[model samples]
Target: MTAGDELSDATAEYITANDIEHVQIVGGTGAVSADVASALTTLGVDTVARVEGDSAAAVSVALAGLANDGCGDDLGLVSSDRVALVRGNPDGVVAAAVLASSLAGGYLVTPLVVGDTLPAWVRGCLAATPRNIGADRLNLGVVAVGGTAAVSEATMEAAPDAASSTDALTVRIGAATDTSRDGAINADDPVRPDTATAGTATAISATASPATGPVLSLCFSDAVTATDNVDRVRDVVEVNGIAAVVVNAAGNAGSVCDQSRIDVTLGQTLSAGDVISVDGSSIKLGTSADQRSFGSATATVTAPARDRVRPTISIVGIAGAATARSTFEIAFGDNVALAGTALLANDEVRIVGGPGGTSPAPAVSVAHEPGASAAVATVSRPLRPGDRLIVDPGAVEDGSGNQSAGTSGSAIRAQASPRINQVLMSDLKHTAHATWTVPTGSVAGVGGTGAGITIRAKGDGDAAGAAGNGWSMVFDRASTYSADKPLDIGVSVDPKGKRVTVRFNNGPATATLGDLIAALNGDDKFAALFSAGSPAALWRLPTMRPVLCWAWSRLATWLRASATPVAPSSPSR
Candidate 1:
C-alpha cells in the first residue's frame, strides 16, 4: 500500500530485522512489488501470492482468493496508487500494494457471505510505521459500518420516524488519548450509525484525515428517511463503548484530506510516493523517499516584461501671419528627437497641409523654438483668410524608443481681410454704336464700385466730325446680370460716403462728354477719367481695358443722350 521503492525496502528491512520466517505480497504489479516478492523469497521466506489486475474488479477477485486462504499476518500488497500502509505485527503480517492502475476503480468488493475477516482484508492499506512490535503496541480507534448491530456499544435513541424494517448505518472513531494521532479514514471505509438509534440504514463512502486533532466528521450513507408516522433519526453512535452524537443527516462523501497534502511549515514541498515516517508523534518524508512526486499543486504564473506607451503630438500655439510667412508652434506629449538630420526630411513629422496662401504651396521650414518643448514651422507664402494648416505624426519615437502615436495632426490657421474677385469681361458682346468695359476697382455683389473709366461719343458736340464719331461707353464693375435688354445702373453712397457708379453715355454740345466726366468725378462717383492728351475731350485709351464687360441693345443706346443721370450703382443679384 505504500509507495513503490519505500514499500519494498521498508518491508524487507522490518522482516530481516525481526527474523521473520513467512511473508505474502498481494495485489501489486509494479517493479517494486516484484522486488519485494523476490527479496522475501531470497531471504528464505516463503512467498504466498502476488496479486495483479487490469482493473479494480479483477484485483478484488484476487484479494478474495488470498483472504480465503488466510495464510500469514505480515502481508504485502503493492500498487502505484496513492494508498499507503504500514502495520506492525509480532507474529505474522499481510502486506499488499494497490498500484496506480486499479485504485481509481473505487471499491474493493469482497465475498458477500464472508464475515469480518474478509472485510478487514478489503480495508487494504492502513497508514503507519512498519515495525516488529506486537499488534497491541499501536492502538487503532474502534470503527464500524452497516448491518444489524455490527458496531459494538451502539445505542438507539428516539427519531421522528424509525423504519419499520431493519436499517443500515456507517460509523467512525478517533484516538482515545489527546497525544495519539487521529486515525486516518480511507475511501469506501464502511461506517454505520448506532443500531440502538431509530433511523434508516446509511453508509459512508469518503476518506477523512485530519491534520492534527481528534476531530472527525462522520457522514450518513443517505438522507434521513421517514417511516410509519414518524421521521427516523439516529441520536448517538458509541465508539469504544462511549455514547456520542456523531451521525450527520446530510452526508458529505468524497476525498477529505487536508488541502495541503504534507505540512509545508518545514519548507518541504510534498509529492506522492514520498516515504513518510512518524518521528516523535510527527510524520514526515523519509531520506530515501521516492522522488516521483504526485499531483500538481496550485500556483500562479506571471509574465516577465511589459511594453512602453507611445508618444503623441499636439499644437502648442497658432498665430496669424505678421509678414509674408505663416508660422505654427508644435510640441510632443513625450520628449522626442527628430528622426533624421533635419525636421523636413524626418518621416516622423509630416506637413499634412501645404502652405496657407501659396498657390502651389512650397515645402515648409521648421526651427526649434526658444523653449525646448516646442518647434515653429514657417510657410513661405502669406496666409489668406480661412486658411488651415495641418501637421501629422509618423515615425517619431520617444526617449524609450517607443514610436509616436499614429494619428491626425493638430491643425492651425492664419487670418486676413475679406475680398472678392471681378467678373470676367469676355462674357459680353459689343454693339455698332457703343462699346463697354468693366473697371478694375469693381468687386462681386455690393462690395466694390465700378470706376477708373469714362464713356464718350463722336456726336458729342464735335463739330469737326460729329456725324462719324459714335458714342463710346466705358463700363465700370457691373458684371452680374444676363439679359438682351439694357442693364439698370443707379447711384448710392458706400459706407465710406463715396459715390459709386456703373453707367455712362454720350452727351450734347451744351453738356459735352469732357464736362460730364469731370462733373461725375467731382461728386466721388466712378473713378476719375480725363484725357491727359486733351483735357477738353473725354476719350478711351487702349491701356484702360475693362475689368468686366457686357453689351447693350441698339434701342437702349439712344436713351443715354437725353438723360443727365446720376452715377451708376452696382447691379443687384
Candidate 2:
C-alpha cells in the first residue's frame, strides 16, 4: 500500500460510487496483476487489462487465471498498442473500465499510473484523455442551473414589489367630447385640447348666429362645467355693428317681463372688430379689414405722330461764284441749274421736285470786273445745258493785264522807232536800197586821180573860184580819175567841209575839200540830208553791214503809222 496504490484505490472507489461511465488507469507498473483483475471480476465490473515492458508472459499467465471467472473476455485484457512495449516487456497491467454510457453525453476520467512500463489500456487512456473527453459540452441542451446565492439576495433587495400584485389607472384621451351629459352646458363645438391638464374646456353644444348681419344671437344651455368663481361665458360670434344682450333663460321672465332679458337691432353690416361676450371673456372674429375705393379708373397713353421735314437749299451770289459749289452739286435735282435760273445776288433759291422734299442748288459762274464800268470780259466758257458753273465776281481780270481793274483808256503802245539812216550801210547796199543809204566808197573798176575815182557822187562840181580857175575847176580836178580802177563814192557836206569817201577794191578811201562840199550841197546825186545835230551832216552807209537791220527798220515804221486802237464799250447800269 504505497501512494500510487492508494491513488488507484481511491479512484476506483470514487468511480464505482458515482457510477462513472469510463475509468482509465494510465502508466502503471505490472498488469492489474491477477488478484486485482480477479477482484474487479468478482465485483461484477468489466475491466480491460493492458501490459507494458518485458512482462507480457507473466501478464498473460495472470490474465489466464483471471479469465476463469469469464472475465478474460468479459473483463478484457491486452498488451500495449505500442508494438515495442508489447514485444519487449508486457508484464504490467494498465487497466481502464468502459461502462455503459453515451459517447456524446458522458465525460472521461483518466487516472495517472506511476511506472516506467505501461499496458495498452493505460496508453489508450492517456491518448483518450485528449481524444475521447470533450473540451466543452458537445450539445448544450440542458438548461444551466448555476447561480450565486448573493445574486438572488440582490434581486430581492432591488425589487421590493416583486412579491406584490400590480393595479393600473385608466385615462381616456378626448373622452369628454365623446359623451353628452345632463346639466352640462354647450358653449361651442369643442376643439381638441393640446394637453391633459386638470380642467379647461369649451362646451360642445353651443350655437351662435351667422356673421352676415349686424346682430348676432348666441344660444347655450344654462349649466356649464367651468370651475372658476367668476364663471364668465364667452360667445365667439361674428356679427354686424349691433349690440346684443343676454336673453332670459328658457324664454320666461316674470308674469309680465324679466329684467335679465334684452333685445338687439343692427345699425350697420358686420365687419372686423365686432364681438359679443357675457363678461371679460370675448371672441375675436377677425383682425384686419378689406379696403375699397368708391370710384377708380385707369387711362392708357399713346405717342404722337412725328412730323419730320427734309432739308432745303439756296444760292449765295448772283453774278459771282457760289460760296460752296461742291455742296450745291450733290443737293440739287437733275436739270437743277435751269430750275435755279431766277437765282439772284443773295437770293435763297430753294430747289424742289425731288424724292424727299430736299434738293440741291445749281452751281453758277458769273463774270465781272472789279470797280470798272467797261464791258467786263466774261472770259468763262458758257455752261452747256444742265451744267453747273460758278462765277466769282471778285476774281476778274482787265484787258490792261491788271487782275482787278484798270483805267478805261489804258492800252499797250509799241515803243520801237525806225529811220532810213539808222539802217546799217552794208544792209542798204545789199538788200533794202529804197529805205537805206548806198555805200560811200570807190568802185572797183573805175580809175582814180585822188585817193580813188568815184563812179557815183552826191552832186555836180561848184562855181569858179577867185584864181580864174572856177571853183568847179578845182572840184573837177579833185574828182577827175583815170580808168585804172573802179570805185563807189558817197559825199556829205557840212559847215566844216565836204567829205568824199570812196570804196575801191573792198577798201574805203576819203577826200575832203571846199569844192566837194559845194557839190554835195547841190543835192543832184543824193536825195536829201537830214540833220541829226546842229552841223547839218548827211548820214553815211557802210558797205559791209548785216542785211537784217535794213529790213526791220522799214517794216517797223510802216506798221507803227498804219496801226489802230479800239475802245471798249461801257457796262450796263
Candidate 3:
C-alpha cells in the first residue's frame, strides 16, 4: 500500500490495546519500515527503530529476541546487521528482536561500555534473561536470542605476569679547597692589629680554615711596614691560605707602618708618603712631602683659503647705422671682480647680431674696451639692421671696462613704426550718373499724379570723399490735375547715411526740409513731404482755337511768370 494508506483494523487495534510504541521491520521484508512505523504510530506509538546488518536473518533473530522479552517499545532495524529499540512497546520490541535474529549471519552487535543506557526494547530483552550461545568472540556476529545475557555477563580481565621494582646508589662530596698551607700567619689573632702604623713596625695575623666544615687556625703575625705612618692596608686571603696585598694612605706619613710601603714604587718618582706594599702583602701611607707633577700639551689650528675671482660682462641690442653709433651698456654681477690693470683702449668688443640680421654673427669692433665696473666702456656708433651688441670677457681687459665678456647674450628686433593715412568722401568719384526718374503718370515739376518716384545708382568710384570732389543730383517735379489729391515724396539712406544729401528741383531746399531730411537720413532715417491737398474746383477753356484746357487758373499765372521761348517763321504756306 502507498504511504498514505491507513493501518488495517486488526493491526491498529492490536497496537492500541497492547500499548505498543513502534514497530521495527527489515527494509527487504514484505513490510516497509516507514509503513510499519506509521501504522504503529497511528495507534498511539511515537518512535521506530532500524537495524544495520549484512543479512536479513541476523536482523530477524535480533527482533525475535526483543519480542519474547514482553516489552512494548518502538523498535528500528538499521544496516542489515544491527537493530535498534526506539520505544517501550511490546509489539515493537518483539518485532525488532525477531527481525534481528532472522538476519543473524549478516548482523554485527556493536560493543557498548558497561552501564551505558540502552533503548527500551533492548533493555526489555536484557531484563528477560535470554539464554547465551558461544558467539561472544566473533567481532561482528549478532547475539539474537542471547544479546543482552552475553553483554551482561562480559567482563574486562587483566593479563597474567606483570610486575615493577626499584633500586638506589650512593653519592659523596669532593674537597673544594687546598690543604697545603705556606708558612704564613693569620691576621685574625687578637694580638694582631687590623690597622698598621705608618713608618713603624706592626703585625698582621689571620685565621685559616678548611672549606669543608672544619677550619684550622694558624696564628702568626707578619711585620706591617709603610713608607709613611698614615698608610692603610687591604689584604685578600686565598682558599689555599695565600694573602694578596693592597694599600691606601691617610694625610700623616707615619701612621701605619705595616701598610706604609705596601704601595711603594722603588726607583720610580712618587709623593714621599705614596703607599707601597711589601712584595706579598698590602700596606699604604700618607706622603712625607707633596711632590707630584703634570704638564700640558698644545693643539694646532687651520683656516680656509680664499677663492680666485673672475669677472664677466654681457651686452645686447647693437644694430643698424643709428644703432652702430648706439652705446650698448654692459652689466657686471656681484659675482664678477675687476683687476686693477686698465683695459687697453680700442680693444675689439664683440657684438652679437639681433633678429634684424639674417644670421647670428659675432662682430668685433676696435672702439670699445673694459671699464672699472667690469663693464665695457662703449662709445655710440652707427649700427646696421640686425646688429646686436655682445661683450666677451677675454683673458685681457678691453679699455671699455675691467669686465670680461659673458659666455652668452640675447637681442630683440626693433619695433617697426606704424604708418597711417586719412581719406575724405569728397575724394571718391562716381563713374556713373546718380539719376532719379518720375513714376508713370508723374511730371518732372510741380505736383504729379499719385505715382511713386524711382532712383537708380548707376556706378560709383572713390567712395571716400576727397578735397573738391563730391556728388551732385537733379530732381524734377511735374504739374498735373487731380481732385483732392496731394503728391508725397519720401527719401532714405542705408547704413545710417554717414554721407548722403537731399535737394529739391535742382536747388537748395529750406532749412525745414533739410532738417527733416537730415533727421530721416541720420543713421537710418526715413522722411516724406506732401504737396498742398487743396484741389482746384474750377475748369476753363483756352482763348486760342486749338482748345487747351486749364485745370486751375493759377496755371496761367504760373506760365506767365516763367521765361518763354521765341517762335520761328513758318515756311511758304
Candidate 4:
C-alpha cells in the first residue's frame, strides 16, 4: 500500500474468508503504511501486529491486560542445523511459507537478494534466534533449503559470524546443491524482475534469488495474449542466449484483467551473474500501439566469478614428434582462461624447464581459448627423448578466477634418426664385417637432420693425387752372379739416377740389403705401404726375389769368378 492507501476490497475479503487468525504487517512505514493494518483490527476476529525490518527497535507503549514480558529464547523451528536458510526471493518465500506455516499465523520475512550484503531483517533474525548446541559446537549449520544456488556458499560465508551476545555465530556451510533435506522443492521460475516496457526502453532493475523457481519480468510495447503465450514467450525470451521454457506469465496490474502481468517462474533458480535476454523484434504483441519490438536486451548479470576452488592442469597429448616448437596439448578440469591483467601479469599460462637435459629447452609460452579446458604450449629448443612439459604456477585460471598450481605433463617422444653400419671386408658373399659412425637416437630435432659426409674414389686414369698416385720404388738384379767370382754386384738406390746400382761388394751382402731397407723405411710417405718388417707373403714375388738374391750373393764379380781372375783379367764363361 502507498502512504495513505488502505487494503483493497478483494484482499480484505480474502482475509476474512480464509478465517485467518493473525495479521502481521511486514516492512516499515516506507512499505505498507499503518493504515493498511488498521483494517484488520476493524474485523475484530484475531490479533494484529506489525514486524518492522528494524530488528532491534525499542518501543515504550503501554498495554494493559496483556502479559508481554518478552519473547523467550525458544528458537522453535525444527531445523537440526541451527540456520534456517529460507528463500531470499519473495516468490520462493511464499512457496516455503505455504508449505511450512499454519493458516493461523501470518508469515512476513523480507527476502535476502544481494550477494554480499545481508538484509537487515536476516541479520536481526540470526542474532535474535537461539541456536541448537549440537554436533559438539555452537556454530550455525548452514543448510541450503533448495539447491545450492538457493544461497551460494560464497554469499553465506560473507554474513556476520558473531551474535550480539558472547556466542560466536561461526557458520559451518554444507553443499548448496544438497537437496536431501526437508522442504526441498524445485521452483518453476527463473529470475523475474519488474516489467521492462519496450516503448519506454526501461532498463530492468531487480535482483532474483532462490536456486529453484527463478523469475524474470519483461514488458511488450503492446500486450500479449494468454493462449499459447508461454510458448510465444519462450520463443523470444532467452536465458544465457538459449531459449527457456516459460512456466508462467501475467500482466503487472491484476490477475483477473487480461492485462495482468505474466511473471516468469523458471523451473530452475538463477545463479549469480546470469544474463537474461529478450528478442523484442520477434515478439507479437496484442495491442493498437506500434508492433515494433524492444530490440535485443539483456535481463541482467552483475557479479564476478566467485568460484571457491582452484584449477589444475594435466598434459593430454603431444602433437607428432617433439621439436623446438613442438605443441604440448594440455587440459584443466574446468573452463580456463589466460586473459585480463591478473592472468597476463603473472604469466598465467607458461611452460617451464628444469636443470635436467630436457627436450625443447624451457622458457615456453602458453595459449588458450576463452571458456575452454584445453591449451597448447610452444617449446623453445630442440626436443630430446627426455623432454617433458612443465607449467608455471599461476599460469592459468578457471571461470571462477581461481589460479592453477604448478603442473608437469607426460614426456615427449624424440624422433629416431637413421644410422650407418658397415660390414667386414671379405671375399665371401655373406661375410658379416661392419663399421659405422652415428647411432640412432634423437638425431632429427627441430633443426632436422644435418648434412652427412660425402666420399668418391679416383679411377685408374683419374687425375687422382699429386705424383700420379704417389711415388714408387722398384728393385732389380743390376748384374748376374757366378760361383767362382767374388760377389761383384752390391745393391744401392740412386735417387737421381733412378736405378738400383749393383757392383762387386767388399763388405757383407746383408749390409747392402740393410741399406736398401733403411732408405725405404726412412721415408714416412712410403712407410704405410711398405714397412721394413712387413710379412713377406703379402709382398709381390719380384720385390722379394731381388732382396733374396742380394742377401746371399757371393763376394765376386762376373769377370773374376774362376780363380779370382788374376789382376782384373776377364773370366772365361
TM-score winner among the candidates?
A: 4
Question: In model 3, what lDDT does residue 391 have?
Answer: 42
lDDT sort, best first:
4, 1, 3, 2
Looking at candidate 4, what is the lDDT of residue 22? 71
C-alpha TM-score for every candidate = 0.17, 0.11, 0.16, 0.23
- In lDDT terms, how accurate is model 4? 0.38
* lDDT values for all models: 0.30, 0.23, 0.29, 0.38
Name model 2 segments beyond 4 Å from true: 1-378, 382-437, 440-518, 521-573
Candidate 2 lDDT over residue span 222-315, tens digit each: 1111122111222212123223322211111221111111112222332223333332123111002111111211111112222232112212
lDDT value for model 1: 0.30
lDDT of 4 at 201: 15
Q: Between the candidate structures 2 and 4, which one is better when assessed by TM-score?
A: 4
Best by lDDT: 4
Residues 294-395, candidate 1: write the lDDT tens digits: 111111111213337565555432335455445555565542233332222223343444345445544566676332545666655543444444554443
* Segments in model 4 whose C-alpha atoms lie over 4 Å from true places: 1-306, 317-325, 335-361, 369-372, 412-573
lDDT of 4 by residue, 1-573 (tens): 223367778778878889877765555665567777787788654887664543321110111001122221221333221333444445345545643453213322222333334555455544543322221212333333455556666557544452321122111111122121111111111232322221211222112222134445443322344444434555666667876545444434311111212345454445555667766556644323212234565645333334566665667333335334456667666433333433322254444443465545466666766656566766666444445676678776765567778877654443376322222232221111110111111111111132111011111112122211212222223334343332233334433432323233332222222223334444443333223321111111111111122222342342223211111111111
